[model samples]
Target: MVSRKTLAGAVAVVGLLVSAQGANALSIKEALAATYQNNPTLNASRAQLRATDEGVPQALAGWRPTITASGRYGYSWENQRGTYFEHANYAASISVTQPLFRGFRTVNSTRQAESIVRAQREDLRVAEQNALFQAATSYMDVIRDTALVSLRRSDLKFQEEQVRASKDRFNVGEGTRTDVSQAESGRARAQSALNTSLANLNTSRAIFRQVIGIDPKNLSARTNVTSLLPKTVSSAISIGQEEHPSIQSSLFMVDAAQFAVKTAQGVLLPSADLLGEASLTDSNATGNLGPESRSATIYGRVTIPIYQSGSEYSAVRQAKEDLGRTEILVDVSRDSIRAQAISSWGQLNASIASITAAEAQVAAARLALEGVIEEQRVGQRTTLDVLDTQSDLVDARVTLVTAQRDRVVAAYQVLSSIGRLDYDNLGLSGARYDPTEHYRLVRDKWIGLRTPDGR
Candidate 1:
């Protein structure tokens, strides 16, 4: 008869095997840090943010004076009354033009640029959150699939042993041939399941590499992010609307679009500028004349726009339409964020319940399987009964593992929905990318071809 001690030993062996495999496991925090540093999508978003930083300088250029220098050298020939003459002339000029007024166009344009830069910063934040969430999900997936593979392999081994035992019993006239055939069929199904699980593990590993930027090693189970989540769904939605990067970015975009409308309206107003020029000219002819002259001038210029084939008015109308569209987009972003928060909150709650139920199921299945094995040894239970109980135990254990993985992933999803999945909130240890430092370095910079860090 199968004793309780024997079943307990079997459980201990499985535990030891899992523990040995996890000795070199990678933690979730380390995986997130690696993704933050190496993810191509996140890095691309940062590069785009840096590119947006240049918009401020481009806008500020409108308020600064422009200086230009030009030089021309030419030869001239003329023929009159059968006589030919040749002359060479050289002229050089330097000019400066400073904008005195432009109906606040530069001011509104600068405001627009600044607003856009702020929006892009929020976009970068969103990208970071997404990358971290993906890494966490992939990490959980690998752990779940790995555990399933191990469970399936163990089940296959048990089924193979059951088939051998049934055959021996049938040969000795203690078991029927039908019992041996059932055992063999169960073993075949277990083998198939193991193959499927191995394939799933490979797929999970591929995704882990794609998201985490490296091959997955022994991955440890991670603590859930439930502590970082809101206590209630209402609070989660409130926080998401207030702090979600997508919503924040949309708000800034609305502001930028408003400024763009003002900038377009400014085009209809008069513009004024101060202009200064200095020039030197030299002329020489082969016959007898050579003259050199220098001149300087400073003046104020005013330009008033009257008509332009209706293009300027059309531009103002277009800008206003764009502003309206952006305002609507702000609403859209809020609705989308709210929905995500609610859905993620629901998922988290469901996963918690599933884990609870799965744990109970595993415990019950284990006891049932042990009882069946004990009964079969005393001829009370058939071989088919034992095989069915074992299969139930394997499935229950797999369900429990899957539920645990879902719980972890769902918690992270909740954090991400409310914009708290970033490195700062997670307390990930790494070199955080600071967008403000780059903005500060380049915002007022007058002249430099290279970036602040000499990139």
Candidate 2:
């Protein structure tokens, strides 16, 4: 029977192991959604987008009539015949000022605000797309490292078997000391590879945690290799140009700049304003019985841009220059999108080819290793030959795993280039964690994109 202390120790050990497992168990989809929802960088960008929603109200200000109220109170006193009297007067009035015209400035400014709002939305989209790309890349990296670790472990097992075989053969005088030494060296190298792979896996997991706010040690789902290759580069580029968030955001900016130019030009024209005011006042002096007064004013004012030290002209010119710059930037963005799509498309295909070749190489290496082992058994191959072949097999497996992971990641990269790597395209549908849900909840409220409970 176990003592109480031993039972307690065993329970503690089990608890620790369970805690460790829980800490590492995160799936790729979970990580992706968590990062998209909770990542500070992405959330900050969402807030920025919501902040931009205020532009509409600001622009609407130009088109709305403004009302203001004013009030004043005063007390006056004068001494006469050694007697004193005091009086107080209060007046209040409300006025409305309507801008009838401003060289279309109000209209143009409103349009500029609309363009800016659209641009900000595109900016948010770009941010989301980039975050998804980074999260996906890190997820694949961890998977690749994990695969390498498995490969190293298998190699070590194979080498250990070889060492056992060599020991038995040497005991029977059928193998030399060199055979045993070679097997030992092979096992050591395998152990080193295993250690390297483990370290790399840890590093990848750390980055994954940093990005998605979760450790992914339990994310063991295999990537579907069959779905990794795209059908055509032209199709990819076309989709990317149409949907890529960066290009879309840049295009929106170009439109906004165009509107700004119009608004600036409108500043060179005449403007009309309607102003009115009314006031009531009362005053009493020590000698006088009492005093009272009233006043009122109403007028329509039209101001034409006579001159402004060339500042208005300079603004118009500067806006035109800005429009020109934005037009060029749009073209530049188009070219950049095309280049990225094409480059990633090419890499996707290259990775596919490399994976196929690596698979073939792995098969050939395994066969060669087996042949070298047989030759060593028959005294036709040196111990080093067997060890070298074993090393080649390990390298072949490593290359295959790398190629496969790259191919899978490249597929996503291609999708990312085309801006199609979103939840819908990826089929992350149904009651899944929706990052945009939070944005929608507070979008119409004055507080904007934040929960009432202040998450």
Candidate 3:
């Protein structure tokens, strides 16, 4: 069974490609920038971070005063001492209830919300890295497949030339009927290979559009991420454990869980609030002969929780358990990041070695193909010998192309594993999405119906 990472690394029958660089060439960095700005998944993650930012303000609301205004107008009929009277009454009131103390629930909840928002930022980082990685892969795939198609088409043309030459030689009694048959057979196989390569190229192009959200045009395969990576595998693993978004997010979750436990316990403690109210009422109690009344008062009250239900205790205990779970998950995330970093490091090393060997192999295969063709021309080698050598050359060149693409992809994998594959590291100068900008705008907002973007 192929390893998951290696499955897509090598094309079954690939070919060599010469990269072109033009002023308008779409570099991998530009592709990544496009993906960062246009990928739906990355954009959704950013939106989710903004939603999490709202949690901070929601938590802060617990510390703010609750103000309300109410008014009522109605008619009532009453009979007393054999006399009946109907009166219209109206009342309007405004009240404010400010929490003088909430047993530290507001403080703990606010801290928890802040922690959660931090975790969400890390989550957005993860999503960004994932989107960029996939975009890079799609870009490389299209290049590799396109090269294969070009090589196969050239091969088909060579086979066609060989078929005509063999038939002419057989007609002149310089070659046997077997030579013509073999040439024709090779031509047929080349046609089939060309067809397959064309299909693969189309598939790659479709995937490229799906991931990058743009049709590829003069895309340059220039994703070199090794410079952003650490020097050694051990160092990479260490850095990944420390800086990987998953690990950081998990750590924040642990902190948030701890604060959540505290918030839960706060519910079991005493609470205090200050209430102020002003009201004006007009009543006709004496058959439309009554004066309007207005009153205003301010009062403070505190209540000690004796016992309402056992649910609060249950909630506190559950929160403590959740905190423990989050703490353990921090270690889990660290281990996972370490493993990924080490694996990516090994892949990068392998890709570098493969590129060197593949280049040498392609050169040797091309020389061998030339020698075989000369031998066949002098009647020292069979026509099949020349065809087989050509096939070998094609395979060697294909391997080289695949190796080059793999090298770029492996470097990205290594950079991403250590959490360094980001817009800043990639040198993308496009408009940056700042999650903290939204967070800062909303954190201390006391009143707002619209979002930071006026949505």
The best candidate in terms of TM-score:
1
lDDT of every predicted structure (CA atoms):
0.87, 0.72, 0.85
Judged by whole-model lDDT over C-alpha atoms, candidate 1 comes out at 0.87
Residue lDDT tens for model 2, 259-285: 788888888888899998877766665
Residues 27-98, model 3: lDDT tens digits = 888899899889988888998999899999999999899999999999888898999878789999999999
Worst 10 residues of 1 by lDDT: 12-21
- Give lDDT for model 3: 0.85
Q: What tens-digit string does per-residue lDDT give for candidate 1 at 1-455? A: 33465455444432321243465767888899999999999999999999999999899989999999999999998888988888899999999999999988999999999999999999999999999989999988888888788778777778877888898889889999999899999999999998999999999999999999999887776564677888999999999999999999999999999999999999999999999999999988887677999999999999999987899899999999999999999999999999999998898889889878977887898889988887887799998899889888887777778777887888999999998899899888879899888888898988889988787
Off by over 4 Å in 1: 1-24, 287-289
Choose 2 or 3, whichever is better by lDDT: 3
Best by lDDT: 1
Candidate 2, number of clashes:
0
TM-score of each model, paired residue for residue = 0.93, 0.81, 0.91
